[model samples]
Every structure is written in C-alpha cells, then in structure tokens.
Target: MNTTRTLIAAAIATVGTAAHAVDLKAGEWDIAIGGIVNAYYTHTSCSGSQAVGGAALATKGLGCGGTDGRTVIGNGLLPNALTTTAKTRQEGLDISATLMIGAAVASGDAISNNNNNVDVRQGFVTFGNADMGTVKLGRDYGLFGSSAILGDMTLLGAGAPVAATQRNRVTLGHIGSGYTYLGTYGQIAYSLPTSGGFSATVALMSPVDAGTAIGRNEPQLQALATARFGGGKAWLGVKRQKFEGTGGAASFTMNAAEVGASFSAGALGFAANVQSGKGLGVLTDGDSGNRKQTNVLLQATWQATAKTKFGLNWGESRLKDGAATDLRSNTNVTAGLYYGLTRSVTLVAELSRTTSKPVTGEQARMNGFALGGIVFF
Candidate 1:
C-alpha cells in the first residue's frame, strides 16, 4: 500500500483496538496498569513466654516480645501491589494476560531487598466468551476458598495478626488461622458457562511431592460448583490425590472438601465457610501423609453510610494427627471499619485477637490494633 493508505490503515487499527481495553495503547496490543499502596501502624501485646522453636511465636526473645508490647509499621490484609494487564478481542472472545506483583512498603528497606519485596502474585492467561466457557492456565488463586476470601470484609484491612518479626509486609485474613491455605499454583482450569447464576469448574494441577522411595504418578484433581440465589451465593469443592512410592512404605492418599456461602441483606452482609481433609497438607503443598486438617471461617459486615462501613470476622484452623507428632490450632477474631476518603482512597482501622496452641506446648495469645490507608490507581 502507499504511504497515505498505510497511515489510514494504522489509524483504523487503533480505533478498532480502542473498543477492547484501556490505559495505554501500543501497536496491536492494549496496555492497562493499576496498583494499591497501603501501609499500617500496629501495636501488639503478646501473652506467652514459651519458645518452642517456630519462627512465628510470642516469647520474651521472639516475635514482638511477650508481655512487653511491640509497635511497628506493617501492611494491612491487602499488600501494596501493582498489576499490569493486556488483552485483545479475537473471534468474539476476550484473550487476556495479567501480571501482579507485591511491593515492599513498610520494610524501611530503601533498596527493596526485603524478603517480601516484589514477589509475583499472579501471572496468567485466560480465554473467555460471554456465552461459552472460560479456560485459564498459569499461576493463580486456587478455586476452593477463593470466594471466601474475596468476600471477606477484612480484605481491605488487617485481620489475623501473625508474628511481628517475621511479618511479610501484609496481614493474613484468616489464612493459616481459620482455613487451609488456598495458595497460588500452576494449573489448567476450565469454567463451565454460567447459567441462571450458577457455574462449575474443573482443574488438573501438579500433585504434591511427598518424599518417599519414589514419586507419585498422577496429578491432583479438583472440582468446584457454585449457585446463586436470593441475596447469597454458595459453593462446594472437592479434591482427591494419591502419593505412592515403591519399596516398603505404604501409599499416601488425601481427600478434601469445602463448603462456603456469602449473602447480603440490605446493608448487612454475611459470609461463612468450612473445610476438612484427611492427609491434605495444611498449606496444600502436595506433601502426602496421614494427617488431618480442618478449618472454619465466618464474617459479617454493615454499611453504616455511603462511604463508611463496619465489619467483624472470625476463623479457626486445626491440625490433628499431623506428621509433626502433635496437634496444632489457631483461632483469630477481627473487627474493623473502612471509610472511603475518596473514590480511589480509603482509610482503614482494625482490632484483632489471635491465639495459637499446640497439643503439648504453652498457648500464646496476641492482641493487635492497626490504622492504615490504601490508595488505588
């Protein structure tokens, strides 16, 4: 084509791409960038003198100090993060990719060399259709408890108080305390088309590698189905896996299940979930064993005003017959408020109490209060 024809074709291509995405445009691709910056000042009082050995504990010489009270700067439940996305419309389908990373905000490390600095939170590609289904591959959140945490009121603030010295720039919203951790993992997942407010998902994931004479021979299988009714949504998920090695030891098997729901009536919202498993790793690391793990979570929120909200949440996680030769459990309760200072800025405050206990060890209790702000762009 001639120079004039080429220029006109380029202009037309730009206009055609504008209907798909926003932020910035480059060649045939649309670029979008966004992020959240959050920081909190926290005061925690610990009640325990026992020092078993874990990096996360409340002893006179460990984490935050027991009975002496410690104050520090940390992150809320939502860490300071940056996300960049690119997408294109092809054959009536949305083909997209996303990259999410966390920043070290409160580490006081000017070089961002801290342990929690700049870790990849998500890197995934997806293809979806409004009438058809969706397929995703790469690293992303798991399906079992995604809704429970997404609907949690504490997602905007600190919920469970972890070890201060070992804090990772962000608080846990009942992750290790109330539910089996739903970590990000590599998987090929497919979501059935949504129909009448219902949908289902099936995934094949890399299996856990329990150390034995040999490695397991199969990938883990997971499935989840959700239904929406009235003002709430409910979900059920199940997972099954087996780790076998030849030699003298027996094969290890894991069976896990979870159920959860979220509902809203007027300005009041509630959410709850429960999970149990035999031989499922507490953090879903794919380590096969004969241990038992269980967890429960509950939350309630109220929108007091257009820009002001109040919320309370609780959760518990337990491990019985664990490979460690003892039982362990954690329970946490949190109450907080969120006030929107502007359309893209928010003020958050929270108070939380958590207890950690082991079968034959001293129990530890921690009380913490946090004040923070989050800016989104």
Candidate 2:
C-alpha cells in the first residue's frame, strides 16, 4: 500500500545487463511489462516479561506480541508486483497509463481454506508535456514520506515481520520504527517538469481514518520538492489535513513535515531522514488526541564486491505526548547482506532487533532473521 515516484525502479533494481522491462510497439502506442517476485523465510524471537502490545508499540500486535516467537514464509516489504505501462503521444500531448497488481505468497495461517490477497496498488493515468508539466489522476503513491521509504535499504528484503501467525500480509520493513508508511491513495496530482535535477509535486489525496474517530470533509494535501547534486539527493515534503470530531471526540488538524537526504561516496552510501508533526500517529497517520511525534531513520551501505553488498541501519519513532502508561518509542537496528546470484535475481539475508519502551516500564525486545530471494524482469 505504499509507493514513491521511484517505487518501480527502486524496488526492482536494474541488475547487470538483464532487462528490467520488455517493450513492445503496437501502432501508435508503446507498451512495457515489468514485475518483481520475492519470498522470505522469517523467524522472530521475543523477550521481556512486560506485554508490549498496544501500550508501547503503536502498531501493536505486529512484529511480536510478547514472549511468543513466530516464524513465517511470506513477501517482504515490497510485495510481488506485476506492472504494465502504455504510452503514446497524441495531439501534442504526452499520455500514459499504469496498472500494477501486487500479490502475496502466504495464505491465512489459521484458515482451513483461504487464499492470499491481491492488491491493485496503482491504477493511474497521466497527460502532459515537459513544457507544461504533468497531471495525474486515479491512485498512486502519495507525496509525503515518499523519500524516507525509498531511502530505506530494507525495501529489497524483509526487515521485520508481523505476528508469527500473520502470514497473508507482507513483512514490516522498518515501517513502524523508521518511518510511517506513506500508503498509496487515490488522488489528483501534478508534477512539475524536472529542470537541473530539481522537481516538485503536489497532490490532493483521499482521506484516511487512521484508527481515529473523525470526520474528513476535505481531501488531504501533500507536496514535495526534491534536489539532486553530484552524488547526493535531498527532499522536503509536507502534508495537511482537517478533521472534525464525530460523536464526542474533539476536532483537530493534522500537519506534518519531513526532510531527507542521501549521499553516495565510492562504494559506500548513506541516508538520513527525519519527520515531525502534530496529530500524526506514531506508527501511521491521524491521532484522536492530536499527539506530537517524531521519527528518524539513518542508513549506511557498502558495495563489498561486484556481486556482494552489506548494509546496516537504525531507526526509531518517538511520541512526545503520552501518559505514563502510554506507548513511548519503537526502535530497530538491522544488518543485511545481499548477493546477486544472477542477472535478475538476488539472495538476501538480514538480522534485525526491535525494542519498544514505555514511559515507565520494562521494555520489550524482539530479534528477527530473514532469508529470501527476489527476482526481477
């Protein structure tokens, strides 16, 4: 349920000389087909006597629920996607359409007869030229927090898994710890043509309830600006939304801002991102009480060899407003090794430790390991 401007390319790296897409020409239209398929065997172990359920982890019941550890075979952060694009030029206009379907490998664990779910993550169309920018309609990636998720190295593999029993959903890859998932949404958006490695985008997206009881009468506003220089890229993004309380809750407004940058030197790459806002849920979006929260993610990667890579990252999300018993912070650290087994396939292994701390209580901890392979074409 998440995507960035570079979601496709970033999720499925163009490895070696293997073609990431297949192009065909039919009359006046050009068509391309591409996709990624991945699966992982994940094991998680948890400790600490304190129940870290809803009190300390905002995405409670996810990852680990206590001393019980679970194992699963499932999709990673980025699900299996089959995407197709068709483009053509007509009447001095650049027109294109995209449709992507995502699938999962795991089925309901406890269900006697159940199948995995498929997500129509992206179904959008665009029309415009370089001189006039582009207008996008339908569902696509949101503007806010786009850079943060793209900057995360775990996008290629699983970083954390939800409850051991939950198999149908994709694993959590630093989602609640590093940054809130900027889920895909139906929207009408515009992108200013790129110039000098700089570009901008703005969108009005569908409203989300975000586990809160509120009335959303208007669309959410999201915008982003990005700049690239040399081996570095930086971005700034903001989002705003209005909420009217339903029942007895109080009315509130949600506002958030984020800044992120990534730099590469030699075989080493680094990334950092920070987001802070009011009414932004610690793990997701809106909050009924309009709490303040901040999240930070830092990453480093090394290209060990022509076909081998190593990476390490740490991230945390903290809530500034909470009672003594309320959740406080969720943090995670992960190390990974990725090897290119073939032109279009990669072998991945990752280890991660997650910790959740409350305002006043013993913290909870979980350690996880994931082994997987992903292929692209």
Candidate 3:
C-alpha cells in the first residue's frame, strides 16, 4: 500500500478515498510522484430559445451557440496533471514541498504550431509534524467548498461540456451551476494536528477585486473544520473578504459558507452539501453588487461490482439581486457509469442535463453525453 504523501492523493483522501503514489527514498529525503490523465468525447444538444442579450445567468448555456448539436473531444473537469513531492525530517521537524503541473489534452487546432494550455496549479511547502500544526505557504486550493468538489462524482469524469470550438477547454462539471470554484490561491495557512478525529484549517489568502471594489487593502480569510468517523465525514467552511471603494465605486464585502458530508454503507455511498453567500458570484468569487447567492448539491453512488460503479447527482446555484423579482439559477444533473479496467485505469460514461433559468426570459437547456477514460498513477 502507498502512503498518502502526494497533495493530489491527500485531496482525494478528504472524501474517504485515496490514490497510490509511487514513492522513492534518496538518502535522507523521501520523494513521490502521482497524478491523473483523462480525455472524453462529448456531444451537446440544446433546446428552448436562448435568452436575449447577455444575461449574467446565461453562464455556460451548455456552451451551445444554437439549437444545433455540437461535438467535442477534450479534457473533462479534471485536466491531466503531474504532481511531484519531496519530504524530509530535519531537526525534529518534517518538511515537504510539492509542485503540480496540469495541461489540457486537446492542445489546440490543426495549425502548424498551436499553443497548449499549461498551468501550475499547486506550488507549496510545508514544515511541521503531527505534534505541532503544519503551516503551508504558497499557492494551493482554498478550504471553502473543497470537500464539496472533491466528493463530487463528476470529478472523475465530464459533467458539462461548453463550446465545441474550444477543444482545449475543460468541461464545467457543475462548477458554475452547483458551486463556486474553490480556485487555487496564494496564501499562508495553518492546519491543526488531528485530535479526536477532528481537524481544522485557517488561511489568510491573497485578495482579489470584489465586483467593482478593490481588495488590495486586506487579505481574504478562509477557514474549515472537518470531522471523521467510521465510514463517514463532515465539513464546514467559510470565506470572507472586504473590498475598498475605488474610483468612486462603493465598498462591499464578500462572505460565504458551506457545509457538506459524505458516507458509505455496504458499497453504497451518499453525499450532500449546501452553500450560501453574499457577493459571491454564481461561478467566481467576485461579481458586481452584494447579491445573495446559494448552491446545493446532492449525490449518490453504488459499487455494483468489484469493477463497476454507478452514480447520480444533482446541483444548482441561484443568484438573487436586491430586486424581488430578479433571480437567476443554473442547474445540472448527471448520471454516470464507471468501470475499472485495471488497478490504475477506469472507463467512464455519463449523461448530463443543464438548464439556465432567468426571472424573465426563455430557459436555456442542454443535454450532453460523454465517454472517456482516466488513469491514475
């Protein structure tokens, strides 16, 4: 069995699952490497008239430009990634550093030389031991909504594909519809050593603009508390930040909270989460105004056989402005079948439906099907 040494593996562990990372020892330092690579072919069909003009709620609209269906071959919600880590104990303190690089498999068009999309998602260092809380410095995923996304079944496959023209893009996977993306952030954070099956984390993260206001004056604060028990776990997280008025713009604050839980019994798994916030946009953190937003996610999975699993999920995000009648929502549902072809490879097939509903306009709806495979190592 492999130890949980890689950051990616640690992420998966949050949801009561783990991945095997190949490890090596070089003298005094221990090294490990692991990641995932996946690709999918997706077809999206649209129905109902699209809303006129640009509506913030229009969001992805299934990336459909018209009623005609579109086909795309590209990466899913998760891009191909390669994570490397090195750790050592010095002077009674354990230290480690990790760097994760990810790229889209679709590359680009058939041009002679098309550029690919590559990014460094995680670059951080940690120093501490179980006796003392660990401190993380640099860039990594935020705590808020981290569990929600990690526990999502679509994390292993495609949920919603947008724009067939941009093959290099990754699928949505309920990002804008279900939950705000817990984007990686530059920050200083501390994780308390686990005690009594409970642990917590707090971070002061790099700031960003909140709608029209600027947040350069202060840092974003994020915290999370998690509890683990037999065959189950639960978590709660919060995020808060203040933005200053710039160029006569009004000042505003962004605050968000989320709660989630996951558990398994007799090869059957269930998960659910809820998020509500102000000034938290449907997709990203910042949007104009201190609008109220809420998100809900529900999922269930069953291990039908040693080599096969089935999953179904529903999620929605709603944004409401000050106006009583101005409300917009995005919703998506996905049904997936996963088969383990090998110890380190899995095949996936998924069908998904997405809808965008505005207070006054035609609803934009899309249906999609995806087939893909993912390998972990």
Tens digits of per-residue lDDT for model 2, 1-377: 11234465765542232546999999999999988889898877777645444424323355554336777788888778888989999999999999999877777556642254677889999998889989999998778887887778888888766653236667767777878778788999988988999989989988877554553689889999999999989999999887777767767788999999999899999999998888766556674248787889999999888888899999998877566656678898989998898878889999998888876777877788889988888
Could you say which candidate leads in TM-score? 2
TM-scores, all candidates, are: 0.82, 0.93, 0.90
Q: How would you encode candidate 3's per-residue C-alpha lDDT over 1-377 as one tens digit per residue?
A: 01113334643442334457889999999999889888898888777656522223223433553435777777887877899889999999999988999877664456532254576888989888888989899888888878888788888788766644236657777787788888788989998888888989899999977546878878999999989899999999999998787778887789999999999999899999999988776666766357788999999999998788899999998877544224477788999998888777778999998877766766777788889888777
lDDT-superior candidate, 1 or 3: 3
The reply for model 1, stretches above 4 Å from the true place, is 1-22, 49-69, 108-112, 164-166, 208-216, 243-251, 283-289, 322-325, 360-362
lDDT tens readout by residue for model 1, 223-287? 88889899888999888778775566667677889999988899888899998887655444434
What do the candidate models score in CA lDDT, each in turn?
0.67, 0.78, 0.77
Candidates by TM-score, descending order: 2, 3, 1
Could you tell which candidate, 2 or 3, scores higher by lDDT?
2
Q: Give the CA lDDT, 0 to 100, for residue 66 in model 1.
A: 45
Question: lDDT of candidate 2 vs native?
Answer: 0.78
Q: State each model's C-alpha RMSD to the native.
A: 8.7, 2.7, 3.2
The alpha-carbon lDDT assigned to residue 348 of candidate 2 equals 92
Candidate 3 local lDDT, residue 266: 96
Q: Cα lDDT of model 1 overall?
A: 0.67
User: Best candidate per lDDT, number?
Assistant: 2
